[model samples]
Target: MSHVSSICLRNSAFSLLVSVFILMLTACGDLRESKVDGYGLPVVQIEMNSETLGLLLGQVTSKRPVAAEVKMQGDVKMKCEVSFAGQSSLNDYRKSLNLRACKNHPSEQTRFRLAAQNRDKTTNRAILAYEMFARTGMTVPTTELVSAYVNHDFLGVYLLTEPISSEYFHRRGIRVADIYQSKFGNAGFRKEFSSNLSEAFDYEGDGKDNYAALQGVYKTLWDNLSDEEFERRIEMQIDVDNFMSYMATAVYTAHWDGFDNNYFMALDKTKRKLIVAPWDLDRVWEKAFEFNPADFLSRNQLLFRMMTISSFRKVFASKLDLLLENFPVEVQLSNLEMKKAHSQSALAMDKVNGPDLEASFDGFEEQIKVWNEKIRTFRNTIAE
Candidate 1:
């Protein structure tokens, strides 16, 4: 009787253990499956010290970068600084992120930008703008979609890009020291030059603030001189081709934020020339496309000054026409659709109620139709 009872008890215990194992397996399977759609894109899993992250997020003015454990693709782990980035984006429904190497990662290879793309609604503008700029023979940041998780909380699909910093220059073998970022200010050349707001034009890299070169260039542009003198001096100070190409892209993309607010000037001090670069293309392909391109540059004085020069105006007009003729809108839209397809599931799962990414794509398609018609009208106006 005792042996039979013991055998029954043992069998019952085994069944219970089997049931538990099956339950555990099912739970693990769900966890793995939930994040499966997140494949194809790099998964940036951030392990944040809750207190440190809280402090970073709660700060009003002083944004102290906090350390986090960053694991990419479930393999590479590095210590990185996580900080809130952008002006309006900081106050927006979704805030952008700036990551830099705090420790362990290489100093010259560790900064990355993750844009919120809140205003963009479509989340495609940044990528489209960057690609368009790159197509115009400009050195722009490499961008991709990333599924970001902070302490197991899904932050949804983010536009992960290489920040235009010293690291960016190093990768391209460009020796640039004095890098200044543009910010909110009067779009006049003199105003931009004299802007003392730390947020207006920030010095990048660990180099000494060398404003002498930039100031000298500003003085040349500031002076009222003969068209020939102005053209020659401006060309000497800037990469005219790059500037024109940037302008053309901006006009084509209808990037209202491009000219004055969202750009960086990288000075090759030895060459004494500035390379204009694009940034923050989240506000493109909208109302500007419907309005006059000339009207869009209401505050950008440099371009206004250049418009007065017939020779420069002709070249600029030609560049705009060429970009309009060659811009691959269809291909770019296709690429955008592909990216949205890849990132849709993860973005839909965003905890912060990030906009309906799929619906935004539809809106983007409609905007493109409007943009095409407006562009044709602009071309016609310019022709006449």
Candidate 2:
């Protein structure tokens, strides 16, 4: 009887130890999983009713928003409206999303964009663009690399960015009389494109007729006035210094889509001048490092008119020289490395577009070198 009792006691002790060991392993695993990586990029989880999600998924091309709930760790869970965003990315398997916090929400930020990065294999192009722009003292959207989940499924890495809105300007203490976003590719300030001006730009103000001012000042005046008068009118309507900086940044970054489209024009309430801001920078840095600065002037009438003015041309050259001198190549490379490390796991898990996405870092250094050389050559040519 004593031996049997001893055997039972040992078995019971062994069982209890095994259970405790399993529990400890689970706790450690959980801790490891919870550890934030990549400079503490937050996780944003969105939940929505199945029916609404289905409706959203059904319309690939529609911009109509659907109701949903958004929750970011350490932030208030709020009701939000979700919609498909981006022109070319709409058909992508991993579609970009636009989220707007419903009115009366406690959150300070009302609108934001989640870039799918479907075309950006490096996932850092937009981020690099914004960083470069910010270095030049340009107002750009703040961005973060985040792991996004919807309906309890991991959707992969997303670039969480602030949308250009009233809130965006308000945060920076900027007062704008009007805001217009270029919606179509024909948003150039040319008399030929003026007919489609309404289709090209979406005005955020009360009166659509306000677009006539933009046309009259930037297009009609250029055609009807002498060079001196046109320059005077242009300087009054547009902040020439700001515009020059914007052009320099756009050219240096190879932002092919930004000059006439994928940009915002805000009329400053104080200065009463139009300020250009860049958006959708994903298309940059992909082309070969061989482009003439002159090529850009021909594409937009506003650019052509500005470049024709000798004084404005000098300003633009100065801005370009300043940009090239202060280009943060090493810092940008380090940023790319950090983002790659942080997003590696998510990218691997991105079954939709990950497999097709090439490893962009392999040629990144060489690309940067070539770009720098080309830009320097162009600058020297322009100097002569």
Candidate 3:
């Protein structure tokens, strides 16, 4: 298991022990009420039957189907199945959730993700990243801020997001022949692993062997081919523009966890080329960006190899410049400031349930300033 997963498992055990202690305290006639209140964001009230709620709580590691009614701002009501979501967020006191099969929703949107945003105290990184991608003309999931609650108990502010799927492409007037979500930690395109490549990609499309063409591309790219031939063939299969935009976004945001597994690939039928869809963006901008630009991309060998080519390297560098031009530090700070204003009040109430209630938001603000400086320094270094 991964290091984070191990920590999560240990945390889960500790949480269970804490729960037992709380029960004991209650039994001794000493009880404390939870002090969580809804944030100013639109409230997502989920009403689950007692049996279904118990079932959901019981299946902490696995997803259990629990019937629930979800209402947003007292307007949109959905009858859906609720399941705990995410790798580490499942272990959180306020767990992230996945809602599926909401009434009257499009088939592609049968599911929605409510991210816990635990890492980002600002709780705007994912939303900011998604908006940045859209501003750059990339197809990405739409996100909204919502205050989620279960059975009258306020959970906290969550980012309600649409999932990347074939239906997502259809809605955007793009036809996807195939889609694959890269497996975590196994980002390389190794032909020797072709037999099980399908398992790694997590094939999301209809066809049985849609990964066959992708495997062939991987073999041709690595095994034997002139640079010219390889570039021509690879360009035919993968959209270079899309790839550049994705890499630029990752670098600009200093997303350490982005490249390898936190992305999806779709075959756009019109272009007959692969397009990248970014995912799991909450960890971006965790610190000042000062590492070698190459360090950001060392994990994914395909992109690493492409960078060795002068022409591809030039395109990648140009994309980075364009990203810096388009998303300046001032613009990003303004966006962050707006989001902070909208969420700070909610976060204040929400933090009462977590350990960071005493922490100042000034630290987060300082980090943002550090990020802006890092971006400028990195961009200048790259230019030189």
What are the models' TM-scores?
0.81, 0.83, 0.84
Task: Tally clashes: model 1.
Answer: 0
Regions of candidate 3 where Cα sits further than 4 Å from its true position = 1-38, 105-108, 190-195, 207-209, 352-361, 380-384
* Superposition error at 287 for model 3 (Å): 4.0
lDDT of 1 by residue, 165-218 (tens): 877877887788778888775333545455443545777756577665567666
The lDDT per prediction is: 0.67, 0.69, 0.69
Give the per-residue lDDT digits (tens) of candidate 3, residues 71-184: 774556788888777766666555667888778553435678888777776677888888777666688887888877665555667888877887677878899888888775
* Deviation of model 2 at 354, angstroms: 3.9
Span of 10 residues, lowest total lDDT, candidate 3: 17-26
Q: Which scores greater on lDDT, model 1 or model 2? A: 2
Candidate 1 — which residues are off by over 4 angstroms? Answer: 1-40, 102-108, 187-200, 205-208, 351-355, 380-384
TM-score of 2: 0.83
RMSDs, each prediction? 11.5, 12.5, 5.7
Candidate 2 lDDT tens digits, 304-356 = 77777789888878877777767756655676777677666666655553675
User: For model 2, where is the 10-residue window of minimal lDDT?
Assistant: 13-22
Any residue pairs clashing in model 1, and if so which? none
